[model samples]
Target: MVRNVESSVDDVYEWLLKKGVSQKISQIFRELLAEHGLKQHISDATHRLGHTLDVLITREDSSILKGIPFVADPGICDNNGNRSGDPLAIRTLLRLSKAPRERRTVIFRKIHDINIDNFRKDLDFSSVTYKEASVEKLIIHYNRVLTATIDVHAPLKSKEIVIRPNTPWFTDDLYSAKRDRRKAERLMRRTNLAVHKDIFNQKCMQVTKLIQHCKSQFYINKIQEIGSDSKQLFKLTNNLMGNTNLSVLLEHDSEIDLASKFGEFFIGKIQKIRENLCSLTKSPTREVVLRADIKFDGIPLEAFEPMSIAEVCDIIGDAPTKSCKLDPIPTNVLKQCSESILPIITEIINKSFSEASVPLDFKKAIVRPLIKRQGLDKDEFKNYRPVSNLPFLSKVLEKAVASRLEKYLNDYQLHDNVQSAYRSSHSTETALLRLHHDITS
Candidate 1:
């Protein structure tokens, strides 16, 4: 049943003969191997004593050992590849199959290429009128109208692309330099000129220097930005050292399940906090109020003043052009079309102010889970934190409400003088400086 073997049978026969074994015995041994569907493939002596002790044995019918040649070396080598004294060494090459290319679908809109003037014109012509209705209905109408307008101008498109590992330091400058280097190399090869050769070498050196500068600058900026955040800094360091790896999943696990698991963990955590608060409220603390005798009558804030169209336009213009998938229009598009959309947005805010209720749509947010830091168990829910990305319009409305609330607080002098958080020109740094001054004085 055996067809072939990849070992030197003739070399083994000669070694057997040199070992003083009879020719008849060697023939019998070969016949026995054939009868058993087995073959010995080691043709050369494996030991220093000229004995073929180490041999590659395989089934004659099997192709697994076929096309594989082994080199029998009498010694080992050091790090510099120089041979050192050793018992023996067998070297062989094993070629493994290439890994399959992984692909993912990217859905995006070409927001940069949009003509803002045309978009504003389209919005001016579009009807966003709604009848007197509940705030919920009005919010739904606003989202639908703006989403439809954006779809007409900048429709979403999907493309499948191969996923590859990339360095964070890679930039457009490096890409252009690499392209120029390729052109120079091609010219050098085609022309066979000394000038072209020198140009190619110079381009190579330039690219190398550019890459080093970019990598160093990337790390330097990253360290400065995250210097105050130790957790983030450690994560960046671990990623740079190549110690971090992606989370692995089992065959039965799906991304949806993982998301649900994270959601449940957060919900349970909030429930625990609520339970603790309820228990504490049932048994009140005996602490005394520090400013119980300081009583000043200040006008209480009952309702928020409605924001005007100009105020709404200013808010949108000043806000960052960061968008979420839930947003009906990208922030930049909204800003550009502010003149046309301000009236509706102003109405929505006024309606919300009079009703004393935020729209349900505004309350919705897309939550993503991220690991708290590197070197933590990725599978554990406690190690991950939830980050909510809210729609751009929701943020605009929030800024409007915060502005009114802040004005009320300032008008009555209701806030504590030493309070640092959420106050203009105040931060932990200022708080620490004040503490230091108090101690010194």
Candidate 2:
């Protein structure tokens, strides 16, 4: 009866293990087993099992765990007054794991000399005590506080350039108002160069045309009187030149008066056009790329993804699996994720979340459903089954899949109406490809 009960308990423990029960629960079970003198039986049962079982049962179990009071040991002080290799002291220092060896050594030396009680008192956390916290928890708390501090001060650090008020020019009372007006006119002209350029170009062309027309009219009227006295003609031409000069001076003054009156409206219109262009340039636009790969029993077969030059470099460096499996198909289907299929999927998920403007937790929501639908564990790749010897059909199906994914990603709009369309399209494409392959075989 005792043996049967022991077996039953073991079975319950195994069931809980499969369900991913907490370490505390597992430890409690182990204690119960030890109390029943079934520890020997468990040892025998787990003799052939991997060491992972032992580690999990020991380190992860909190029920049998006792909190240890951290004691400070004295030593020499470094520049930062932090100690090395001591987890508690390291946590107190808030030093990054990736700190330089020299820096770490200094930190270690400094922390080793500190009096724990006095240090705690110095911090003056009367409301909060560092009494019974693990190294991991301490590190996490420090990081949180540091992050909060940075966030609070971030806005003040961001200095934006602004236009300052113009200083008034010093002048005599007689010409001060007139001088100020002239200065204002000059400032306006200098600032609105594009508007002035357009106006000047247009008016210059108009003036040139008017001068040509006048010259043409004079020549046409005298065409039949070519034999008239040359001296008399020269005198007449000089008089006409004088009259033209006077007329041009009057026209110039009139144009300047017109500009003084209406220049603001033209300049404002130009400025508005520029501001519109600037806003358009800064507006967000969707940039989509389809990346897909087919794997045959975990080994990548074909990979393709339409990528820019910078993306290509990143893909080469980070995604070696993609480099190995070059896509053979000539279709628009480019295979993308080849290095680690999981990371590729994660990248896709991230892109989707970003496009949707949803929190990253949505990734977990989508991933769980997809994993369940596939009836595969998150780490279950060992049992992956490859499609049988239908090389041509497989290639065709893969290409079709790529094409469908590309089209969907490219056209997907993250609006309420079309948000699910990409996901639906992907599913449909995969299903159809599977069906077609099955029927053909």
Candidate 3:
């Protein structure tokens, strides 16, 4: 992030340099230098807390020279014959001791570069170090601000309701059990409905308040009434609305009809508010579902045929020889088998329209396995394997493993010594292969 910021600034600087604005830019550089010099002076003066104490002590004495103690050399002789110590330093210390008591108000005013008298009027400085002030004033001022800002009220109100049934004579203990159970169930249902209604109402009210708050007139009015503590008012209002008990409101609703009506009204209002807000702002961008087509050259392949596991093993033969003796199948026969069995391969190559050849090693490795797995005899041309039996072949082909292997082999270009070793190894392997062929024959 810092590098990016530096790069952006450098770009602007370079642009300015090209435009020949170096002389004009020096004005800003000079202002920055002045600021740095002021900062250095402040840093040197307040190198430690002791330095602050010295400044405070010295500032109190109007008669003391500014640079006397700081610049005075004790080694140098003065005309006053004060060989024991630096005369200027001694005089400055004496003057500081004799000076009038320093007022914190005056010091703070000077440091802040503000008028002390006016600032004191605007702020309650009883807790601050003014020479004459009572602690009670500080407490009162602090309490007033705290009381104005903080909410100390409970938001919920509770009430109990007594329900009398339509039938009065059903008052026996057994009857009362049945009656009470029904009443309790009804009350529970009502309470739940009321609670839901209350929550919905509160949500709607919040949306309404938010809309009102967004209005310029409402914000201005609120600020005018609350002064600088409008934030406290908004927070208190939100807390009060959030804490309001919906269950209490629900208990007052006698019938389910009334509860349902109120719930619908609240929901409708919320929906309307949502629509209004959404319309005023930009509608959210819809998520685009990306899909890719597996096209062979220009057209989708109608059939797919994969190499069987047996074919794979055949291609990567377990023989100890450097290379296995492959069966000499005719090119036309192999091409026909490729077209009929390896439909997936054909599909990948865009329905045999592609110019690229199926790699010889890959065809041997993959196709044989698929054919074997499908339980098809390689010699029997009558029994061809179904394309759907081997779905994994298509996935394997998609991996581009052959391309990766080719890249790896190409990248392994041998250095001089490594090349010599590789060539020697190759020669020995070739000689062994020839001898093995003769012996096996």
C-alpha RMSD for every candidate: 9.3, 43.2, 41.8
- Candidate 3 residue 80 Cα shift, in angstroms, is 42
Off by over 4 Å in 1: 1-66, 73-93, 96-100, 124-131, 165-252, 284-293
Measured against the true structure, the TM-scores of the candidates, in listed sequence, are 0.68, 0.11, 0.12
- Candidate 2: what lDDT? 0.38
Clashes of each: 1, 16, 22
Off by over 4 Å in 2: 1-155, 158-162, 165-404, 407-441
From the highest lDDT down, the ranking of the candidates is 1, 2, 3
Q: Write the per-residue lDDT of candidate 3 for residues 105-160, one digit (tens) a residue.
A: 21111223333343223332234331232333322333343223221211123444
TM-score ranking of the models: 1, 3, 2
**Ten contiguous residues with the weakest lDDT in model 3:** 39-48
Best by TM-score: 1
Candidate 3 structure lDDT: 0.38
Q: Summarize candidate 2's per-residue lDDT along 219-272 as a digit string, tens digits.
A: 656644655778767765775566422211112447556335344544565699
List the global CA lDDT of all models.
0.79, 0.38, 0.38
Q: Which stretches of candidate 3 lie over 4 Å from their true place?
A: 1-26, 34-301, 310-395, 399-441
lDDT of 1: 0.79
